[model samples]
Target: MIEVRAPEPGDLETIGREAREEWVRDRFRTGVDFSPLMDKPNTHVALIDGQPVAAGGFIDRGNGNAIAWSVLGRVDERHFVGLVRAFRKYMKATPYRWIEAHCIATFHQSHRWVKCLGFVPVNGERCFTPDGREFRKYVFRNHNGS
Candidate 1:
């Protein structure tokens, strides 16, 4: 069974490594770093058979809202749904009135998943790749207090 829980300090290295791998595979970019957010109190990890497979976090932007980001691999929909439900509850308990996610257009699965979760597209534009190639930037937002 896959479980979603608060991230621990010891999980930082593993999460960062997986994130870097995903980054390289998805964007053809290496040397990417996630140290800035690892071990942050707001981050969470998804564990399957006791191994970390996905991770994400939120930044409290004040004003009863927060900006959120997540990284996922090919995972089961059941697990993903559970994580979203948990995160929704987390948002409600905190001061956050909204949660936002920015995704690369190349990640079609991600875009579909976010839309399924009721995240409305607020805006989109071209984002430059490391090699100067342009990709679409999709911004999704979920309002909670409404």
Candidate 2:
């Protein structure tokens, strides 16, 4: 079964390794550390049979809202749905009134999934890689508790 839970200190090493591998495979720099970002109080991990498959967190913008980002590996739809449901429960119990995410336009599958999850595109911006390669950034927002 896939489960989502708050991240534990023991998971830091594993999460850091996974994030590093992902960055390398995705052609990013070696310094793309997620540790500082995931240090937030609400950071979470999606586990399948006790193996972490994904990580995400909510960063408060201090205006009754939070921005969230989830780095997921190739997983089944069941796990994806479970993660979303868990995130909803977590946010509903928090002080955040809004949630948003910035997704890469190249990730077509993620675009569709986010849309199905009720995240509409609110805006688009240009993002550049370390090498100055440009990419489209799609901002998606969800309100009304989802």
Winning candidate number (TM-score): 2
Q: For residues 8-61, what per-residue lDDT tens digits would candidate 1 score against the true structure?
A: 654545544555346535431344556566655677777877877667777767
Question: Distance from true position, residue 134, model 1, in Å?
Answer: 6.3
Alpha carbon lDDT of residue 127, candidate 1? Answer: 64
For all predictions, the C-alpha RMSD in Å is 4.1, 4.0
lDDT of 2: 0.62
- Model 2 earns a TM-score of 0.69
| Model 1 alpha-carbon miss at residue 95, Å | 2.2
Which residue pairs collide in model 2, if any? none
Clash count per candidate: 1, 0
> Can you write out model 2's per-residue Cα lDDT over 36-68, one digit (the tens) per residue?
767888788778778776677778888777877
Give the lDDT of residue 107 in candidate 2: 59
